[model samples]
Structures are given as C-alpha cells and as structure tokens.
Target chain A: MKLRRIEGDLWEIPREGRMRVPGRVYSVGPPAPDDPALQQVANVAHLPGILRFSLAMPDIHWGYGFPIGGVAAMDAEHGAVSPGGVGYDINCGVRVLTTALEAEDVRPRLHAVTAQLYRDIPTGVGAKSAIPRLSDDALDEVLAGGARWAVRRGFAAASDDAERCEEGGRLSGADPSAVSARARTRGADQLGTLGSGNHFLEVDRIAEVYDPVVAEAFGLVPGRVAIQIHTGSRGLGYQVCDEFVAEIAARRGEFGEDYATLPDPQLAAAPIASALGQRYLGAMQAAANFAWANRQVMTGLAVRALLHALAISERELGARVLYDVCHNVAKLEEHAVDGVVRRVLVHRKGATRCFGPGDPRVPAPYRAAGQPVLIPGDMGRYSYVLAGTARAMADTFGSSCHGAGRLMSRGEALRRGRGRSIARELAARGIEVIARGKKTLAEEMSEAYKDVAQVVAVMDGAGISRLVARLEPMGVIKG
Target chain B: MRLSLPQPYEDLGHTADVGVRTRGATAEEALARLVLAFAALAAGGAAVAAEREERVAVEGGPGLAGSAVALLRELLYRLATEALVPAACEVLRVDAAGTEAVVAFGRRDPVLHAEGADLKAVTWHAARLEREGAGWVAQAVFDI
Candidate 1:
C-alpha cells in the first residue's frame, strides 16, 4: 500500500515501523490492486538484517505466509530465513532436459512415452511412489548431498550434461538433524513422485529462437526435443511448513506486533533472532536438498522411460540435464549494499535467482554465461529460457519474474470449461495430454494463465534477463 | 443438479463436488434449495429425509459475486473436515456482507455415503455463480 513508482517496471514500498528496509516490486504495469504482493513486500521488511529491499516479481499472487512471486534478502549473520518465504514445496522448481533426438524421432512413440512416464513417475495427491525407500542414513546423505548423491549411486552420469545445473544439483548447509521425524515419515516413500497441484512433466520441442548465442549456450536448437520436469519435495516440505507455521504463531508475542502481525493468519512470522527461526532455516535447507535429489531420481526414471519407449540405449537418446534451478527457495548469498559486499539470506518464493554471468555463485562452466533461468508457460503457449545479467544484480540483487502468472483461478477455469471437451480441444491443437485426474486437467486448461512470452519480453526489454529460446509442448503428463 | 460422494485422498475420508442448476422465482430460494440438494447427496436421501432446523450465515463481498459457488466450497471444507452439514441458506444478504448467511443442516457425519470422489483442495480455476436465462446457475472444480 506504500507503493510509489520508481521507474518503468519498478515500484518501491518504503519500509515502515520495525521494517529494516523498503520493499521493491517488478511489474510491467501497475500491479493488480487486490494482489497481496505489496503486503508480502511489507512483511519481508520485518526480518532481521534485511538488505536493500523486499522484492516481488510481476507474476505475484496471494499465497500463504508470502506472496507467490515474493523475494527478500536477509543478512546471513544477523538476518532470519523463514521457511514461509520458500514455501511448502521446498526446492519445488523446474528442470529443462534437452535431448539430441528430434521431435520427429519421438512423434510415433508419443503415447507409449507418456504412458511410460506416467507409470514410471508416481503422481496425484497423497500418491505414494514405488521408488525404493532410503535408509535413515541414506536419506540424510541425500538431503545433504542432493544430485551428487544420485550421481554417486549411478543414477546420473557426470558428463557435459552434469555441470549445467545449479550447484550441479546440490546445496550447502543442509543439516538433516534439523528436520523432524514427522517430515521424514511423509517423505519416506515419495522420492520420485510428482505431487499434484501445478506439477507436470512435459515433452516439448525448441519451437523458436529469440537469441542465437544464448540458445546455443543452453544446448537448445529449433526442432530439438526436450523434457521439462516441474515438482518439489512433496510431503516432507509440507510437514516442514505446517510445523513451522504453528511454532512461529505460538511464539509470535516474542517478536513484537510489527514482526508478527497476521493480517492473514497464515502469514504469521517471527523475528530472525528467535530459536524457531534458526531451526526452520536448517530444516528448510535440508528439505531443499531432498527436493533436488527427488528431481534427479525422477530425471533418471524419465531417461529409463524414454530408452524403453524408443527402444534405444541411453547414448542414442542423448537425454541429458541441461539445467535444474530451484524457483522457490531461500539461500545465503553476498550482494552489495551501498556498494559494499554483504551476506544476506535471499528468499525467492515463486521466483528464480538470476545471477549474472561471472557471479561467483554460478556454476564454473556457466560462470561466463550467467545462471540459466527457465520460465514455463501453460500448456497452450510458449515457455521461455533466459540468462541472468549484471543489470539485474545492480538493480534487483539479481532477480526476475518466474512464469505466466495465473489470470483465472482453477475454479474459474473449470466453470468456463463445463460442457466443452478441454482434452479434445488440446488434442485438436496437436498436444497430446494424459493425467490421472479430470479435475486437474480441467483446472490447467490453457486459458487459465497469461501469455508467458509477453511476460518474458518485458523482463528482456527491462534488461533483468536475456531471452535464450522458446519451448513448445509436444506431450504433457499432469498430476 | 448432481450430488454424490467421491473417493477419499489424504485428509478427509470422502469428499463431494456438487454441480447445481435450477430455475425459479426467488434467487434465495434457489440457493437454499441448492444447499439442500448438496445436503441430501452428502447425507444420502435416507439419512437426510428426517429434517432438523439450523441457522447459519454465508459471507463475501465485491470479490464474491459468484460467492454462491465459493459458499459450497466453504461448506464442503467444513463438512468434510469439521463434520458440519448445511440445511438451508437464508440468502437474505447476497454479496453485500463480507460473508454470507444460511440456515444449514447441522449434524455430525450426516451418514456419509460409501462411494465418493477424493476431492482435494478447492481450486481457484473455473469457479462461477451466474445468472442464466430463467434463473441462477453455478459450477466449481474441486481438486481430486
């Protein structure tokens, strides 16, 4: 509500009360009045050691605790990292896996490939997966080591494909001791599961090229096939959030009203100095590692499904990890404050990190090209690939929009979809779809979201990110 | 109007996704009747045949022009989780109050049916309560 326009695609919400800094939002136009993005921005100001501004991306939407497109940076030593900022789906993000195989190569096997994927990857709400459960020690190791654990287990190959991921699919400071028994219980058998609600694995092809150099860097070429996996930590992450929210609410009095105001009861929060705050951060990091591991294992399953469906060896399919980035997460990173370097806990909720080329945090192989940012559109439209830029670092601590924000809610989309055969409509358009739930398919109808291409264009024009390539869906498997 | 129980998923044992269509002289009566229809489907015609009186309030404002649809979701969540059943909605106030009021069938369990879809959370997609040619109609999609 304290918003004032700073420039094109930029707005500021000055920090007030116990807030440590002002809040910043990135939108091409004035944000929707009902959007709670400003409120989320204001809430981030309450975290201790917060630097520069609490930020929100253009796809902002109302969410529990933090607005979906919210971002905030808290000092590593003195600031608090709230699990609410990263959301219940810890490390719930998108991974784009490119293959040398062309769309035509997989066209004939589309149905079999989708069925294989669905059979191999567990899905639906509360759906328990068939993937083997890990021992307590193995689970802890997975939490601490992430994709590296899978690679060591022979699930992934360390090749040119291995270095493109964020931290090569691993994160630091993951202490499994911080996680609770209940969290472990929920996550035990869900390793390769694709939890329901906005999660999907889509088969796609490079549909268009917006930037030749960036596309080449990302190994994407027009007509080349790819697979996009969108998921997260599942039940483990949900239990973590549920436990923390209750804990924070019970101790809300200690932080004072400014830090604990529950304008929405779900947004209840506490100061960074609190014990619960530290525990939540530790557990969140551990869950994030689990998510990365989950994706890695799922990616392995995807490879197996493709190999069997296409009747070829792994070398022939050339299915490799292009890049895996966590969109919903919080990490400790160094950023400039008044032109001086400082460590801060950056919370990216429904947002992705856009570290510029040469940023120390980026993986070594991609240090010269910046972090690969994947923005996926709804099934009917084009998804974009972008690279982080120094401009984003100088302005937004290196942040950018995530996807085509929802324009119509699932219920709204379903009401409009009544009597009309949504699946038939999509099939008519050439996209084969498969899902266990009719409701999930109806809610995800292509008309439910804004055009992601347009949103990416705004960020590209604004110079926060540069266009890499566009991906169009060939086959989609939803939960 | 169609009402039936769906399979249970994680939280509740069984959930119901109700679809209502009606034509009448009074909008309030139509909404009340719709709630009754849902109650019957939830309780089954056998258990709900015996009627009891209960009063309740439904709430929403500018954001809930289609609140008739959201009201069902609120009722469903409460019914499945809290075991509260609705009998009737007064509908004296429509989209005026921050919330809506109704005279709901108040009971525990309502003798839930054996078969049902596992309606998960209430989704924001395709939710609408609208005015049709003769009366009002509403449709909502529940995550299953």
Candidate 2:
C-alpha cells in the first residue's frame, strides 16, 4: 500500500481495490509500506458504505480486523457495523481523577497506598471482585444501567460521575434480553475486577501543565496527586463479542451484503438495518454498560483504599473525576460528511471521542474547555491530558488516538526482558510497581511502546486535540 | 490445567496480541493441540490441575477451520465463566458442521498460579487450518 503525504501529519491511501472511499491516516511518521496496520486501514475502506476515509490515528497498531487506534464512520442508512470494529473489550476505556493531595504527600507514602490498592482492588486471573457477586436480577440492572447503576448502589466516588462520563455512562438502547446466558454467566462475579494484560491502576502526580485554562477546568494543578484507572467489561464483553463475530461468520449473507467480500474474515459485518445488526448493537451496548459500572465500582474502591492508607478524611482527599472516555465502541453521532451533518455510526476501535468545546454533549462545566481526553502512557513514561478541538470535530469524526501504541510485540518484550528486573528499574526511577504476573512488568515496560510524547505530538501538530497536562506515575499496580 | 503433553506449536507474534502455530498428524490431532495451547497460554505458565472431566460438544460453521474456532471459543467460555481450565483435550469427532471432545478440567487456581493474560477473545484474524502432506497445521491469534 502506497501512502501520499496530504500535508502536515496527514496522509492518504487513495481509493483502490474495491474501496468505497480513500483511506486517511494522521501520523508524524507513517508505518512501513507493508505494515499490517496500514493494510487494515485500507481494508476498512473496502467495507460497504464507509464514508470519507477509513482513518488511522497516530498511535495505530495492528489488531484483529480494525487497526487499534483506527476510526471509521458509516452511513447510517446504508453502512455495515462490524463487531470487530467495537473490539472484544466493549467500552475498554480510561478515567482520570483529581485528588487534593500534593505530590509530596503521595511520594512519602507511595508504598503504603500502592499496597492498599493491590489488596482492596483485585487484579489478575480469577481475582474475584471486591464487590460481592451479584444475583441475576442485579446483573440485569447493571447491564441496563451502567455507571448510573453503580452510583445508585454507592459504588462511584462521585454521584455525578455519570454526568461527566461519555454517554453519561449509560447508553440508551441497551436490552438485557439480548445478552446470552453464557455471557451473563461469564460476567456474573466479574464486576469491579481488574483482569490481567495491560489493565492497571496507577497513582499519578501533575508533572506539568500545558493548557493552564483547560487544566484548571479539569481541576489539574501542578504537583497535585491524581489517579488513573484502566479496565473493561471483563468476561461478559468478551463472550458477547465472540458470539457475535462467530454469528456473523456463520451467516454471512443473511445480514444483507455478502461478508465474503471482506478483506479479512474478522471484518465480517452486518448492515445497520439488518436484524442481526440491531441485535448486536443491543448486546454490545449492554456489555458496554457493564464496563462502565465496573469502572465506577473500582473508583469507589480506589478512594476507599486511599482514604485508609493516607489516613485522610474524605473531605481532605477531595477525589473527583476529571473525565472518563471509552476507546472501543460504536456510537450514532452527527458529524459532517462532505459538509452535510447527519447521523452516522462511528466505529472507534482503540480510539477515543473528543467532542470539541461548546458541544452540548459535553458536560456543562467543562463545555468551554472541551471534553477531557485521558491518554495514559507506559508505566515509566509520561501520560497526557488533552482536550477536544473543533479541528478534530471537522476532520476526524471527533476521535483521537487512545495511547502510545505498542512499538514491540509481547513476545519480543519478553525476550528483551530476560534476566532483568523491570520493577527495580522503575524503582530506580522513583516509581513503585507491583503485579501478580512476574513478566507483566517486563512485557509492559516503557520499551514496549512508542514514546507517548511523539504519539500526542502528531495530534497536537495536526490540531486534532490540544495538550492540557502531563502526568507522571509515582506508583503503579497491574494484573 | 495440567496436560500430559507432546505438541508442536510455536509463538506467533503480533503488534498487540499473541498467537500460535500448531501441527498434528490429523485435523483432530491438530485441533486437540490447539485446545491445549489455549489452556497453557491462559494459565500463563502456571501448573494446571485435572480436577474434573467432561465431554464438550460444539456446533461450528461449515468447515474444519470453523470447527477449530468453535472449539477455541468453547474453551475460552469455560475458562471465563466456570474458571475451568483444560488439563487434556481428546478430539472425538471433527467435521464440517461441528466438533466434539472429552476434556479433563481443573478449577483455575488463582492462589496457586501466576495471574495470566486474561485473553479477551479468540480472533479469526489469520486463522488457518489445512492439510499439509499426511498431517494438518493450524494457526490462530488471541486479543490480550
């Protein structure tokens, strides 16, 4: 696949080989000509009814069907919605929170706080949730209500978290009935649990402020301690996605167009108007709800752990949500296609929605500053806080890269990590780390990912999203 | 789960996930090795137990590759929902419509085992199964 530089960090793969539209990628440095991620971007262009370009964010990396950090919008009336596009981890996302404690406060007792978090918030394989197992009826409510359900059940640190979350943490059209018993069984006792492999809970400190106005709006202040949480819908989301992908694979033609024409089998999809598409949408939304509730519950647990470890009153801690955004999801939103604004289903796999300033969808308080976009980097590097921009709304379907994409495969990381203590290295850098798996720290070390600064630079250079603040992890926990 | 093992499978690397390439004397043999491969990877190098034994049956799509995927998904479901990992998998039947096998199981012991990659899903990305000479070979990837 050949790429033509379109100016700045933007590049294009012109329409070719059954493509419905051209493919666009935003990156300072494009991947190799034969990179599978570039081909996946090109493949997404071949799907039925894809509009404009099948876009790839700067942090794009190869994934099953859609490239991670890939985005594509399809015509609501004619396009197909692929389950692989939403990804297996439905609503796999990150949330940034502000705390009243200063950097000095956390640094002195980072070990204690980190230990408390590890104890209170379960991590790793088969680590049951800190929250008690839910009954079927309770699980149904969780499937239906999302973070709002968690807040009502007293699981969120802030009651208004739903208002500050993407889709207010509860997407409409979620039908618990669409969820399978197998899926329910898988999710039964898994809520609020952090599973292994890149899932983490970190304690951060505001290291630098870029857009002071927006940073202040989101309550970020230099030297103030903050927290970042990353996880997803757990087994429930995985099972639903597995069932649907297989469902589409088995009945390719029944969903309208012949999915046999897809560039990859994992790209199997259904028309939005098809019965199977609606069924998948319903189930996906339900799984997404479960993920939201999962995150919210974890938030409550983190706050509790901090309160106990720091020995501070809740009032003194002042932990509040900065923002929460889902990276993998499909949403019906209105975005301009050739200067005409109409509803389209945006498939954001390994991407985030960054609605620009003044968008009514943004929370009222931060509407002037745009949505807070959290970009958590590798454990030893810097994470960034960016804000949505009108430029992003106009050019990229209001989407941005989710993180510093992997630069090395897990196998390669493990090979390089042989006989080295990643934990000790991080400790040498003044960052504390813990994990249930011995090799996780190595596979997820800073060398495994592209420098986040470069990843965020592409977007900022292109005016997609502006940098707001930089966060440095003082302590980390991983599954 | 612990398996009495002899297998041919190598790690296949991707930018974001992990995969396997397995070879066997027959399609069923290849598929059985694939099942054990999932078990071993899910265990993340932890020793598996043979706490229970059961026959698992699955209705796949219209081909051998489809059945391979179906078999993988069933194992993942068992791991995810029941915390049941496979100690051994003996393929009893394999055809265009489905596959059946008897599997030795163990409760996934978090206390005794290192927490492994909670594989999100088994993807059809580059999933391949074909007859190679007198034997068969299969390949598949998992979302971590």
Candidate 3:
C-alpha cells in the first residue's frame, strides 16, 4: 500500500481504486511498509459515505475488518454502519476510581486485597457472576437502564458515578426488544463478570503526576490508590455482533452489486437509513448499555472487596469514580465535515473518544478540564491518564489510542514464557497478581504488549491528547 | 462405526486471534472436523469427550461458503450461550436447494475440563470453504 507522510506523526493514504475517502494514520513515525494494519485502514476507506478519512491511532494493529485502533465517521444519513467496525466486545471500556488510602498503606496487604478481589469477583473462561441470575424482566431493565440500573439496584454508590461516564453511563435508543433471547440468556449470568483475555481489575498508585492541575481535577494525587476496571458486555455483545454479521452477510445481495466488490466479507454493511441498520443500531446500543451496567456492578464489588480486605470502613475507603470511557463503540456525534458540522456515526474500534474542553457533551464537573482519557497498560508497567484536546476534535474525530497494542500473538507469548515464572517476576517488582487461569498470566505478560509509554508519547506529541498523570499497578486480578 | 483417530485439522497462525484449517473427503466431513478443531481451541487440549448429543439446524446461505459460516455460527452460539462444545459432529442431512443442514453434535463434558481462552465469535475474515482437487478444505478464524 502507498502512503505519504502528511506531517510529523501523521500519514495519509491517497484515495485510490474504490476508496470513498483518504486514509489517515497517526503514529510517532510511519508504520512499517508491510504492516497488515495499513491494509485494513485502506479497506475501511472503501466504505460507502465515509467522511474525511478512515483514521488510525498510534497503537494500530491488524484486526478483522477495521484496524484495531481505527476511527471512522460515516454520514448517518447516507453512510453505512458495519458490525466489524464496532468490534465483538461492544463497549469494551475502562473505569477508574480514586480511593482515600495511600499506596504505602496498601503495600503491606497487597496480596490479601488481590486475593479478596479474586474471591469476590468472577474471572476466567465462562465464570459465573457474583450477582444472582437475572430474570427476563430484570435483564430487560439492565439492558434499558445501563449503569443507572446498577445505581437503582444499589450496585453503584451514587448517580454521580453514572454522570462521569461517557454518554452518562447509558446510551439512548437502547431497545431491549431488539436483543434476542439467546443474547439475553448468554448475558443473564455473566453480568459483573470479567471474561478472559486482557480483561482485568487492578489496584494502581498515582506514581507520577504529569500535569498537577489536570491530575488534581481528576482526583489524582501522588501516592493515592486507584482502582481500574477493564471489561465489556461479555457474551451478550458477542452474540449481538455475531447475529448481525451473519444477517448482513446473508443479505449482502440486497445492498446491490457494489457490496459484492468489497475486499472482505466481514466488512458487510447496510446504509444507516435501512431497516436492518436501524435494528442493528438498537441492538448495539442495548449491548453497550449492558457493558456500562457490568462495569458499574464490578465497581461496587471491587469497593466491597477492598473494604473487606483492608478491614476499613466506608468512610475510610472514600472510593469515588473518576471516569469511565468506552473504547469500542459507534456513537452518533456531530463533527465538522469539510467545515460544515453534521451528525455522523463515529466507529471506534480499540480507540477512545477524547472530546476536548468546552464541549458541552462533557460532564459538568469535567467541562473545565476536558474528558479524562483512561489508558491502561500491562500489569508490570505504568498506565496513563490523559486530558482530551482541541487538536483531536479538529483532526482525528476526537479519538485516541486505547491501550498498549499486542506486540506478540498469544501462541508466541506462551512459547516464549515456557519455563519462566511471570508471576514471580511481577512479584519482584512489588506487584501482586491473582489469576484463575494458568496460561492467562503468560499470555498477558507485559512483554506481550508494546511499550505503552511510546504509544502515549505519540498521541501527546500529535496533540490529540495531553498527559495528566501516570499510574503504576500495585495489585492486579485477571481472568 | 467408530470415530477415527488423528483428526484432519491444523492450527493456523493469526495476528490476534486463532485459526484452523481442516481437510476431509467431502464438504460435510471438512465442516465436521472444523467443529472439532473449534472445540480443541476452546478447551485448550484434546481431553474433551463425546458425553452428550444435541441436534442443530441452520439456514445456510447461497453457496458452500455461506453454509459453512451459518453452520459454524450455530455451533458458536451453542458454545457461548450453553457452554456446549462439540466433541464430534455428524452432518445428517444437507438440503442443497434450500442451503440448510441438520447435524448431530456430541457435546463436550463441561464439568471435568481445563478451559482455555473464551472464543467470543467466529469471523468471516479470511474464511474459506472450497473444493481442492479430489478432496475438500475449510478454514476459519475465531475471535478469542
């Protein structure tokens, strides 16, 4: 694929062949010439009614149809929405909560805390949840209400927790009826459960504060403890995407012959105005809501586990949600298209929305400081908290990289990890971990991922998101 | 008749997910082996047993490729929702005109097992189902 450097940290693939728009990628340097992710980026450019560009972030990697860190904005009135663009784990997101305790106070009991979390929270493959099985009616309520359902159910401490989340923790237009019975059955027992592969709950310390002003605004202070939850809609979201991908593939002939010429069958899509498109949007929204509720419930469970482990009172814990952001989703937002602002469906696969300051969509408490972008690194290293910027709004559809993209495949990681003790290595660094699966530790070792610091530096240098604080993991619970 | 040994399936490399390529004397046999391969990937070993049987029906697409996807998806749905991994699959009937099929699957014993990575969904990316010379071949990638 041919690519031209547009500027420092940015490159463009000129519109060619059947492309509707040019492809833009943001990285510290140009991507490798033969990187498959670049081809995926170009493939996304061929989608109908794509606006401005099919974009990628610094941590781009090869994914099914859209690159892992891809961002594409489609004209809601004329463009199409593809299930592959939203990813199977719909609303796979991150949430951070600040605690009153200091890192020093928790160091002596790190293992106990992680052990308590492992006992309280479900992890591993097909793990049952801590919450009781939901009836069909209760499942509908959770689907419709999202995090609000958790708050109403006493799983969330306050409504403010929901307020600090993207879309206020509940996406509108969620139609529970649109969700299939099979999807509901898959989700009924999986709520508040963390599925395998990179999903985790960590206890982190504010190791370094990059910008004290923004860090303080986000309730971060050096030495303080924070909890991060990384998960998503689980089985329900997977089912939703699976059903739609098959449905779209079955009806590919209805979209005319142009659809037949698409490079990949996974890129199957329908115009945003079509009936099938409407059904998919409703179902996707419901799945996104399910994820929000899942996180909210997990947050409550984590707080309880910490309290029980530390033998502390609620007053002493002082656990409060900082923010929650979805990394995989499709949202209808108004963005400037060649100077005119229009509503478009922005698809972010393994990317986070980084809406800048002064945007009214930002929660009132964070309006002065911009949205807090939570980027979690691997357990052995440091993660970052960033503030959104105007540059992101002007350039990449207000998006940023989600995490440290995988550098090695799981099979390779397992092969390299043979005869080595990953847990012991992390323990030497004063990080305690508890995982149910034997291979999960090896598959998710820090070496399996890119240096997240480098990924964040590119975004900071590109002016899409500015650094606020850095967090180092103290204890982790993994599936 | 007894089930044969040394299943005709090989692991295929993917950047972030898992893939399998299978071969058989006919399209039905190829698909059945693909199902077994999926179970192996999900279970992380070859210890799964044919402890139970379940019947499944799928409305496939226009051609063999579409039918393969439809069949795999039904199996995936069962795995995800019911945790029913197929230790073996037998294609009972294939309706060429309607592009559908009925199959009997030997369910994996769920209680005694070491579960591997959760297979979220099957992808159409790089999926193939075709005839090669005298035999048939099928390939697919699963999102883990």
Task: Compute the DockQ of candidate 3.
Answer: 0.63
lDDT of 1 by residue, A60-167 (tens): 665545677788877777666666677767888888898888898788888898889889988765556547777788889988887777666666533433356776
Q: Score the docking of each candidate (DockQ).
A: 0.05, 0.74, 0.63
Q: Which portions of model 3 miss their true places by more than 4 Å?
A: B1-8, B92-112
What order do candidates take by lDDT, descending? Answer: 2, 3, 1
Runs of candidate 1 exceeding 4 Å displacement? A14-20, A157-162, A262-264, A271-274, B1-144
Q: Write the residue-wise lDDT of candidate 3 on A1-479 in tens digits.
A: 89899888899988999988899998756678798888999999988879999999988888888989999999999888999999999999999999999999999998889999899889878777679999999999998999989988777645578998999999898989999988988899999898888999999999999998888889999999999999999999999998998889778789876665678888888888899999999999999999999999999899889989999998899998999999999999999877999999999999999999999999888788889999998989989999999889999889999998887878888888899889999999899988876688988999988899999999999899999999999999888
In order, what fnat does every candidate score? 0.00, 0.89, 0.59
- Compose the digit string of candidate 2's lDDT tens values, residues A1-479: 89999998799998887888898998748658888899999998988879888999999989989999999999989899999999999999998889999989678899999999999999987567578788999999999999999989787667798888988998898988889999888888888888888889999989999988888899999999999999999988988999999998888867554466788889989898898999999999999999999999999999999999999998899999888999999999999888899889999999999999999999998999998888989999889999999999999999999999998999899999999999999999999999987778888999999999999999999999999999999999999
Q: Which ten residues in a row have the lowest lDDT in candidate 3 chain A?
A: A151-160
Q: Rank the candidates by DockQ, best first.
A: 2, 3, 1
lDDT of 3 at A410: 81
Residue A166 lDDT in candidate 3:
94
In the predicted model 3, the residue pairs found to clash are: none
TM-score of 3: 0.96
TM-score for each model: 0.78, 0.97, 0.96
lDDT of 3 at A87: 93
For residues B1-144, write the lDDT of model 1, one tens digit per residue: 222222111111111123334333455545555555455544434343224544445444223434554456556555544445554455554553433554535554312432223233333223344567776644333333
Candidate 2 residue-wise lDDT at B43: 75
